[model samples]
Target chain A: MLNPTITEILLSLMQVSYITLIVLVVSAICGLILGTILTIIVVKKIPVLKQITVTFSSFTRSVPIIIQLFIVFYALPPVIESMGFSTTYITATVASIVALSLYHGGYLVEVFRAAYRALDKGQHEAADSMGYTPIQKFRRITLPQTIPVALPGWGNALIHLIHDTSLVFALGVVDIMGRGQLIAASSYGMNQVKIFLIIAAIYIVLTFLSDAIIRFFEKKNKKFKLDSGLNTKGA
Target chain B: MNFLILFEDFVQLLAVVPQTLLLAITIFILSILIGTVMALIQEYNVPVLKLIVVIVKLLLRGTPLIVLIFLMYYSLPDTVTFLSGLVGLDYNGTNIPPAIILIVAVSFTVASFQAETIRGSFLSINKGQIEAAQSLGYTPYQMFKKIIAPQALVEAIPEFSSSFLIVMKAISLGFMITVVDIFAEARLIATDNSYYVEAFFAAALMYWAISAITVTLSSKYEEYLHSRM
Candidate 1:
């Protein structure tokens, strides 16, 4: 066994921590945008589209994100390569974005669907009596109400996405977990167990910080009173 | 555009259906089995076991599942090698079953989640129901078996169904640790054959079937139980 050292451990933890935050940001943004579009289509209630949205959303949620990343990283390049595009960091980033988007879209659809379903019918009827069109009613009433109702589920989605972002390590993204595993392997060879411990500590730290952000949002959004109002109904 | 090719691989991927379902069902059954027993212990406030249960639940709930899978894979072989060397079993040289490892890791994870749901369900029952069974001179086990267990299971059905789906989907992590489940196999086929659409669509179909069957089964159970009530 190699002699144990403090320096190697510190270096490894630093590298892994930075990667974790980057992956979290990338995945969360991707999930947010895709979630919005899917939420719209799902709420629009297009005849065939509703079933399509539900099916796609639920399937995405049910499948493993690690497998999703593997499929995207491995399969997407060749599919896109047919158009004479070479795979690069941008492609990889875009592919991860798509994967994260698809994964979180499943969550967003659920949030929105539940939000739309939970609103009392009287509000819509009230809007209708005022001669508001479906789109207008949605814009003025349904959409506004959905925001608060979806806030809590949306928070859960964000938390899940942050945690799920760790799976991107398997896709060769070298995210936090990827970096940790690398450092751990290297440290094992070098007899630096403290590095592995430090890296693990970093994950715990980030998770704790993330939980705080979510809890803060949840408490701050209590004014909407839509959380309980939403959880019981459509979801 | 490539629908026919995808259709063919989709059918090919169906071969993994049984394995996926088996993993899911095993984890569901075993976790619930473990979870219920643990929950019962918590209800009785069993001292040392309760502390262990709390810690297990926290770690299980706190860490991501993939991390647990990795930790288990590495830890088991090391332990097995050490044990075999000590006991002279001389059997550590053989490969351990990936499916079994995956089942154990995922089941424990499910148990952490399931125990919470079961406990919640159990506690939700009216106290009088338990006392009523006790007043009938029933022992704690008899009271739980007759009155509490059935109600908790029914109350917990929806959460359980969703958790089952999550666990079913989670088996895809096996591939990361080099266990060739359906998704893992599809990744190889897609990469080797350059049939991304075909391979992934095929896997997606299998995933859909699994999801459909679970949802249908749970709903059926829900209806049957409601009618009986």
Candidate 2:
């Protein structure tokens, strides 16, 4: 087998970026929904549901991503098949997304919880006095305050999610890392170093790019001035 | 779903717990040592060293652990050969074990994160306390031992254990480079019986247990530090 050309590597990286974008967007949305539900359960202290969410969160937090990926990849099919769904569509990419979304959701639970708890109770009471509905209170009061506080943690999680995408290649998703492995292996490992270096450079670029975007939001969050006197009395 | 197979896989995975622990602990200690030196370099503004440390840390932060492991595994031999040739010495890099390479790579990656933790804790020391210690004619060592070390250790413990958990997770990547740590052992068992799910769950359980223990211990130590103060 011949060593891959630069164009081949670039094309592979393009494919990687595409998959990464899908994973990030889908997982972020899923994670937000999961995190909100878990946060609600925990905040309300909903008996069995709270315990189950807590245990699930801990499990996601502790298990290595690779193992989690494998478990999901191998286990989801059987479960889905038993539910009368075809297991044929449960590809490596799908399993990776599921696993990563769960990990993201688990982490966001803490971020949401902390940000939610940091919110001043007076704001809720004030919203209540105004005869605001629950949705109105959440939209007008809860979100604005918690988001600024949560932005930093959320951004950190985003960066981690980007890093976690690199692991998806282990599940044979043909992402950048997987492509690099194939390129090297096809050439009898003669180009392993070069391929690995290229892969690393790609990952670094992705991480820094996301980090800069996160920082921009973080800077914009400063305008809220939520960290000032308003929230101080609550703590 | 098969409880018996899961139990058997769990036992098999547990047998390799020592290997995983040894790797995790060694990497943790080595990284801490390297990270402290890097932190000290930055803390004291040690001229050119600070720039190099910063660059290394940035690179480490950006790159994934598996990439680092692969890069080191592939490049170290050539690097060793080149250095030996330059030094007029006979050395072969192929003789080095995969475990050593994994340790070195993971240590560097973990060290970058640890350096930040150490430096943050170091900076958390109050300037007034240092000034007071100085006025008392205490030596730097005395100031560190009497005042700085305790406070910094307390501040650093929580972050350090988080890094420890990271180290634990990172060693799982060792399976890629043929290091038969717990995760690797699990994969072997799964391949043998096609019980990948059970094998992975067992591995996950061990990882979860280790993390729980680390978190509990660190929090206890933090409490002890608080009580002492």
RMSD of each: 4.1, 2.2
Model 2 whole-model lDDT (C-alpha atoms):
0.87
- Please report how far candidate 1 places residue A43 from its true position, in Å: 2.6
Model 1 over residues B114-220: C-alpha lDDT tens digits?
Answer: 88899999989999998889889999778878898888878999889998887877888888667676787787777787777578767877777777878899999
**Candidate 1 wrong stretches, greater than 4 Å:** A1-7, A47-49, A74-89, A122-152, A184-200, A226-235, B80-95
Clashing pairs for predicted structure model 2, backbone only: none
CA lDDT, candidate 2, residue B5: 91
Best by TM-score: 2
Clashes of each: 0, 0
Task: Kindly list the per-residue Cα lDDT of model 2 for residues A1-235, writing each as its tens digit.
Answer: 4877776766766776777678777887888788889988998899999999999999998998899889999999999999999988899989999999899999998998898888877888889999999989889888778877888788878878877888888888977787788878778888788788888888789789878987888788666646423455443
TM-score of chain A of each: 0.79, 0.90
DockQ computed for model 2 against the true two-chain complex using alpha carbons:
0.83
Error of 2 at A8 (Å): 4.5
Given the true complex, what DockQ would model 1 score? 0.37
